[model samples]
Target: MYRERAIRLAGAVRWESVSAGDEPVRVLPDGCLDLLWSSGRGLLVAGPDRTAHLSVSAPGERWVGLRLPPGVGPAVFGVPADELRDRRVPLADLWGPTAVAVADRVADGRDVAAVLEEVARGRLVAAGGPDPLGAYLAGRLAAGGPVGAVAAEVGLGARALHRRCLRLFGYGPKTLARILRMRRALALARAGTPLAEVSAAAGYADQAHLTRDVRDLAGVPPGVLLRA
Candidate 1:
């Protein structure tokens, strides 16, 4: 089974363990990035995705990952989030010898999550933490606020907000909002809420709106995704 736990780190939401299974798992966009380590594949970085990611695992393969909260990834990774958008790159490519050292530590069977967290914490501290405005924008957008309103609240104009979002989230504010809304709807639906209520409560215009979004972002309808 898959397991996840919250960890104490700025911009890090949790650590996760993905179970090895016969079938692949569909990971939907959640406006976040991940630093992942696999028993056989070493270390990799999962970028912010605009659509569902079909993750496959070999038999007996185990995986550990740290999910970074929105707007926090760029600072920790030392690049604009768009640079890694919709891609998984070898950690060595980004971190050089540091990634190799991390792989060695993982091979030693130490707590992979803790190692990854320490690495991220070090980078964030060196970088002076995430941008306060970006963090504020992320929070407001994830809360289902309108993009225009969020920008205004943060004292940013529309164009300025778009630029900041592209740098921090790898996409525009509208796209980020869409992804966050889909995540909210899915969480509610998986918890056994009816589609109609989920659509309304998640800020969609109607069930059809929710359905279209689910299909577009997740590559499946809500029913199929939930069943999976």
Candidate 2:
């Protein structure tokens, strides 16, 4: 009971879902953050996660979300990404009454997803939009660039790049790279490709390497995620 569509926002997507049953949903980490509205919770934010998140839903609860790409979240949320890592905070907690006003609009029969998109667009503009550095760093790491080499490519030292990643992506370059690699490997595996080939194609040393990394970040083996 979930569906999503790409929106005009850069690298962002709008998604809606309804809880179908009582089972806890397995939400894998994807190096992104989400602006969320729950029927019960109103306005909320989902931070980047370092590990898998088990989402327990009340039956038929509706959810609307605007997912911002990794670096884009820090720009829109106006908080360092690390502070919200693995956490879901009420939007009011950060924006105070301004967020409550946004919640009120959505609750008043306005288009839920559209309201979220409008708010995000407004905030992104005020913040001067997303930083170019974040996109470059994330892109390089996701493309299998070596951490040190990529850091240098950005004219940043290791520690400096690490600091920037913490502020922008809620993790260091190394961890972000691992997460990106895990996602890539999983996507290939889900395409019915063999794990061995997936590992090689996704830049892992071998199948065992892929298994360990996936289990570490996602809290499950490759087969488990595929079946889910």
Candidate 3:
């Protein structure tokens, strides 16, 4: 199993990452935008709105991951999930100018983590301090899924949550909840548990509920992952 976490870089930016996985693993649908960047192997991403897939398999055991912000739509990356029917972009292209800087930094014997930190610091002014989006995400993640509990934690009404989420993450609270829940579900599925058990462990209502979620997010049934 791969243990992944959100890293706080030099700036107020963060990226979800995995350290190991010999073969290219596919990231199923999760209702969130993943700005993946690779250091050793190339990553292939594909899928439709709300159901994108990413495949990264390289020879060397190196670092690679996705960078997802709190907001939605393409602020500066590739096309937003809602805009295209199906598309794919290389990890290098996602960062644009930042990628060039990262290359130079890495060329100068800097680690990817250090480069990420530096890039983050350069954009620190763009985002700093406690962000509404970060708060909302933290609340959602801590709740183990997106629940009404987040509304209370953020001190916002239901309508206010929608508005703030729109202003911050692009997608609404419900959308984010689905995405986070799917992420947890995928993690559980990868752990080699039964579909029904994974569903319950991932906070789904039941096996059918988990199946629906897996099908919607991953474009494949839970059985596929189990067999793999």
- How do all models score by TM-score? 0.95, 0.98, 0.60
Worst 10 residues of 2 by lDDT: 21-30
Model 1, runs deviating above 4 Å: 18-21
* Residue-level lDDT tens digits of model 1 in 1-228: 677777888557555655567787898887787998887788999999999999888877878888988988888888888888899999999989888888888778788888999888888899999887777887888789999989888888999889899889989999999999998898999899999999999999999999999899999999998887
Give the higher-TM-score candidate: 1 or 3: 1
* Order of models, best TM-score first: 2, 1, 3
Colliding pairs, model 2: none
Q: Model 3 residue 90 lDDT?
A: 54
Q: Write the per-residue lDDT of candidate 2 for residues 1-228, one digit (tens) a residue.
A: 999999999889999999976798888887798999999778999999999998987889999999998799998999999999999999999899899899789979999999999999999999998989999998999999999999889899999999999999999999999999999888888888999899999999999999999998888899898888
* Candidate 1 vs candidate 3, lDDT winner: 1
Q: Pick the candidate with the highest TM-score.
A: 2
The residue pairs found clashing in candidate 3 are: 11-120, 29-217, 35-67, 70-169, 71-169, 72-169
Kindly report the root-mean-square deviation of model 1 from the true structure over all alpha carbons: 1.5
What's the TM for model 3?
A: 0.60
